[model samples]
Target: MYIRKKKNTSGSISIQIIKKIKGKSKVIESIGCSKDPDKIERLLKKAHKRIKELEPTLFDSVKQEEQKLKFLPISNEQVIPIGDELFFGAIFDRIFNKKTIFQSVYKANDKHELFKALVISRILYPGSKLYLSDYLFYFKKKEISDEAIYRLVDSLYKDEVKQRIEEAVYKDTLAKVGGKIAVCFYDVTTLFFESESEDDLRRIGFSKEGKLARPQIQLGLFTTLQGYPLSYEVYHGKKYEGHTLLEALLNFQKKFKLKNKPIVVADRGMLNDANIAFLENNGYKYILGAKIKMLPSGIKDKIINLTFIDDNVTHEINIHKTITYKQDKQKHSLDISQRLILTYSSQRAKKDKYLREKALDKLKAKIEYSTNLTKNDLKLSHYAKYLDIVDDCKVEFRLNHNKVLQDSKLDGLKGYLTNDTTLSHKDIIEHYQNLWHIEKAFRISKTDLQIRPIHHRLEHRIKAHILISFVAYAIYKEFEIKTREIKKEYQISYKILRDLIKHVFAIKFDDGEIFPIKLSEVQQKFYDALHS
Candidate 1:
């Protein structure tokens, strides 16, 4: 049946709902002439509903769906969560199975599903593999031994399986969010171990979180400008972070088969003269954070003298013309094409001076009390250069006010370096500023993925543990993309989203039909958003 419009004698119009049966055209219903099209559409809907009610057999599906549009009244409603071990896992599995190519990369085996269960368990509650099975067995009633998980992770380390997974994830991310792998933001972080002694992989290094004297492993993470996980590497605890950049990036460039000259953004720690040359040689462009305070005396004087333009929020940042420098280093000596950008903020200056003075005050107390001064105590005091130490005879010190005043000149300014001279200073500044994407990614990995406190001593197992979290993180990223930004409207925190998936249980009655319990209003909104 369809709508029909007819013209009358007075040039008036009439609309009717018509049904064609075999060869006959019959008027199912008719409405008098109306100027409004919306009124006619409402009449059409009412006519269709009446027809469906009169002929229920022809519209059973529609009737049932209509009933679902409102709540389905159940005489005997029982919410049974026992059947699915975790509805949450089922939701995670959908994201996991759809977004990643893990299954195709590795052959399916007897314990393949169990391997996935470990990943889901980690997302649900991150903890040791040794105790995961116990909780799964008693609380979850899903039994997979910890040794099986150990052996599975052991297999991941064999034959470059972890590398294969990383490769597969890279391919999947590109396919999902299509473009060449461009604009990568890189950063390094340290993860400490709980063990008392140090090993080769987990030697004591400078901890990012200040877990001093603890055995820690450094993790170098790479991500897109949008903070999606791309690739990561684990290095020896005491290994210089500046040295890891060349290897990690070269391996990534080689393995992922990224095309020529993708832009790499990194912080100052990753911006050494050698690494810069390596990047330039490899046909990769980089926008790197620069230690302006540590710059050569000549360049420092030049940069701090530039006039800042803080007129508009969009145009407030100042950018200088391209700055070229001569590097007469032992290994890397060439006329480098570089740009130095200086950014200033009144707020940052206050914070910077406040922190420097705070550290100086702490050093004053330490010099008075610390009888046994060591290298570390000296390192903690940033103003130690200004101190007149007469500790050979007795612990005594005097502060050099001149040096303190000199250091205050560079309080508000920050610097960045980029080799891509083609881009405007604004573009380079914007790209460098997006380094926070990788920073946020590290925060999620460390806090949400709990990629720290190496619970496993075996190197392969440790690698596998990171891989599992990596895959979980990929799923999380896809989820965030789908959900977009609706926290204000939905208040859908991870806990809420997890609970919504976890508590989505069903009841199966005698007729062998499953009925998911009614969702709360907010839950329904989230469900719609997830699917939408």
Candidate 2:
């Protein structure tokens, strides 16, 4: 038999032998050249010389004793085995996990790492501690401690991380959306705590979501055309939402060193006449929600008679526009009427209906339980008492009760007051609606970044914690943007990108060497898109 061999890209060779040939010379020639080129050529020559001593006649004599080349029952399954190269293209990708990203940030390569780690951690495992040891051992198969990770996360809030994120967002959003605009949307939401008692900064206040008098940190968030965070103020939990706008804007102005007079858009919470007049007198144009109940009868009558467009509506209103009204003449003379755009969405009504029904069901269940039990057994008597006996009625249970769906009609109705009237009404509504992005940002910060009650009680640490979360939100936002751009076929959300990063492959070799591969094309593409 004769054998032919050749090498391929895998650093391995394919060998084919013609074993049917006659004579010991053919056998010897096959044996001599069949030696691998990697080893000494002399060894193959010696082996071939020794094999030549055995004659083909000798093989025929031994053929009966040779057991006829069993061939191991050749099967295709065993013949062409699967190799790692079929799916995995690189080793670095198999090694990538949350730990790698954390370590990369922990090394403090950029101010953005703190944010990147928090964001990646949040989207991967929400409301969970991202320990460095677990990250290293499971992710990189190395040892890293909790203290080191904590310090790295803490450092994100120190000097440049927070400032840089704020700077980057403001610079980019402004550059992307440059035009005449006005009255940025301003509102505050509190991130409540489980405990009612903490520090003054964590005191219980009026909960917007009606969270049970729990300690919360008031987050005053401001956004404009694109709904990107322009500025934010973390207030004491006990502060009022209505009272925060002017101060927040003032702080924003001071921080940004802004002197341009810009209009402000605010909710009804900031509706005091004094506040409105103060904004106008300071050369700042203002559009604010006017509570119908608070307005004089004349203005209320005018509002009722005023025709509203079936579609979204925008009208230029100033103190000048209201001159014909007796109420406006009596209310203020220095104010300029800014544009007032009113938008009503049926979707909001549906949402409101859902909320009211849910809240009412809960309230009804509590009231029914309280009435069925003795007053002494009821720990929730105060809540129950308010629900029962409306207008001195004795408690009665019936299958079809006249349960009032309280505030059902206005359940989903949302009102936006904006001062920038130049933009179309739809544009204004769209801009204001983008406020939900802040809610998403907060979810990631609280649940993903795990920035809550907090670990360190020191004020600096608390500030740092918030700063890290802020940076993380920035990173998360950046990822969302990049992923969308790269995976244009569908939305590549933060969760999907996060999962791809965690996926790993193990590589094994005959020499006892093993290593992980890096990210795949999809993964590297997404990561690169984020930077781009």
Candidate 3:
């Protein structure tokens, strides 16, 4: 048998192992095909290896026996496989190249390659910069030192580079969404650091992850209704979540120069007088969560009395209120009309009741077991209102049945405040439901991407780390969209797809020859989906 290199019409070389039988050439095994000269040479070598395995001569058999005997003393643990590259990394690298918004900011060179590698690693294997060199060497077969990575990160934190990236991603996303954004979603999350020290940017605050002792920075993200990220901002950890909305929104609008104002949607945390006035005074429509219990007694009573025939029906109440806000050291008031859309769900009601009962049970246990209950304990517990403390020379605690009854009356009811009168109440509710998309984005970033517990001490490096995670999330969303489009019956999750890609790797020889392992049926389907 001999190795054969055949030229295909597509201007590529196909290597195969051929044998001669009865004066006719028969293809024994088709090794592979490639367009590059180096890959073609590697394929030729693989074909030769295939020929030796198929028809072994006396010398080849002796050589195989010698190789087996040479490694006889080595145990399985010592026989480590080296020089294997992650095929999934290559797939994601291709995806990153196609969706990257940094080409205009950074040139195509080692720095750009390192940036791409960092973003891809954030998705596949998130860790510290110290491991970056080893990660790149294993995945891309390239050498990038830790100091080079730190330098690139510092450069990435520049205001010019950050603005350019945001603009590019915004334009790209706008094009993807058909050049118009009628509605958008905004949300904020906290990313804590691993150290106990505090700086200008990193300070201790109310952490959503319950890491109150660790210093954290707040991240505000703006995304399309479908959860495609448009822009992100890193704020000081101690800033109020509500205060971040206006800055992020104003900056995004000013930078993008949007002609039409998109309706902003956020949860109750962003419902503040200043935000409402800013959205209204600037001619921007908004959908914000309303604190039903905190409303005026007259309005609250009216809402609690309204009866719902079924879950399908919704009740709408018109509210007119004057909001006072401060700007330029001047106080101003604006009177605005909004529709408070209230919906009832049995599932939601059950969840609310379960949570309240759980909290009450814990409060009761604490009161019964502990003899000395300090006022600080009551101050820290949110369920303190459900208990009445009597200080008559001795403190006594009792359950407030009236407060629990009042809360039960409002169970399962959710309110959404909107200024858009054109859309129907059902449309408003449906639009508000899309807020879950942003929540899911945060979940993926915190868990799958591992974006928190930042180790960088410098402010610029922390910002750079967040920027990498932002870009990584964009690519992840694209992958999710593609996988959904490819498989209509059932969608493949990111975790499953990642595992499959992990198994599809290539072996690299000392002479720069690569032999890709055969792909499973499902793996091939997924691979084709990405390549296609």
Candidate 4:
């Protein structure tokens, strides 16, 4: 039998095999006219088997003339793990483009290497500088020292290197977003130290994590609307959240040389009269958080009775009223002329009412059945505010229901203040809602990056340590943005991305060649999306 090709009228050729019989060829079999090699080989095997069945003598000659294929033995005894950190490093460098940026800033490549290793390690396995040597072995087995890491942190703390790095990162982000930034989100979070002692910079203060007994340092993070960090600051743990934004705002403004004044957006805890005045005096506009009950009695009454049309509403909240301040007013020693955007959320109200009622029930139960209270119970001034003790034969406690009702007035209400009246109330609310961007940055830093429970003792080391976390966060955000841009349908979050990067280990053999472990479909998507 011999293979043959027949060109049809459609100009597509069909492949076939024919038997040479009676001086005329007869078609023995026809394979589809496709260019697939595997399919052709499979069809060829079928044709040969048919021929062999007809002529067993042909198989003897075919076997004698067949070429032998060689197979190599693979040794599994020399397997080694090489994590996908190389891919992470490659992506980090691709986004940062630190080739010349670092050379110019650090005066040499060693510090640059140390910085790269530290930041990548921070993203991979965030820890103290002492662990730098251990993490470096994952990268290239570079012999980094505790001293090298300390010097790196010291360089960041003493000099203004962190700002330079941030500028580079922020510039890259602006390029990603087409170079227009009119609004920024700001928020403050506390990072606690393990030690009980407090330094000037690390003081005991109100921690968001409720670690007031632990000395914490406050961090004010500034990010764009998409949660990419533009700049960040470290303050004494006890510093006021309201005061932390000014330094970062002014520094970021001057550093970027912004063309338009950015409308600052922050949560309610970061709002105060002095901060509003400072922001206004600097010719900056703001969308600061306001407590509904903290407003003047007149304003509060108007808000409580105001009727809202369903013109502009979101999922959980409704914009009820927009009041622009034409004349300055003074209340609680705060003189401000700003627009107040009132919003009410049914969901928030429900949550607030539920939480308040639950808290009230808990407090009432404790007062009734918690036995005779000790000084610790008295020290909890909030719980003690509603309690009345009877010292007659035995101690009895009662809760003041009026105080509970007084707090119910502002259950589901939130207020935002802005100096820019040109923006509609809807726009103001929209901007303030994105403050979750900064909130998320703080969460990533605290939870994933492990910026808290700081192990450093000296102030410079602490500052340097935080600076490393900042750099790591910038890289993490940029990488995250790229992954989203390329493949949003997969929903590769930070944790999933980290796990993907962590699991793709290169398996090195006893020979010089190295092979990467087999990746699943999800892992392949991550690799392609980033590389793409």
**Per-model TM-score versus the true fold:** 0.78, 0.56, 0.76, 0.73
Off by over 4 Å in 3: 1-108, 364-375, 387-400, 485-496, 502-520
Number of the top-ranking candidate, with lDDT as the measure = 3
User: lDDT per residue, candidate 3, 417-471, as tens digits?
Assistant: 9999998988898888999999999998998888978999999899999998988
Which structure is stronger by lDDT: 1 or 4?
Answer: 4
**Candidate 1, which ten residues in sequence have the lowest lDDT sum?**
311-320
Clashes of each: 0, 23, 0, 0
Q: Assess the local accuracy of residue 343 in candidate 1 as a C-alpha lDDT between 0 and 100.
A: 77
Per-residue lDDT of model 4, residues 128-197, tens digit only: 6655666776556567666666776677664556666777777877876678877888888888888999
For model 1, residues 121-231, the per-residue Cα lDDT tens digits are 666556677546743653355677657667677877654556656766676677665756668888888888888688778888788888988898888888877777788
Q: Whose TM-score is higher: candidate 1's or candidate 2's? A: 1
lDDT of 1: 0.70
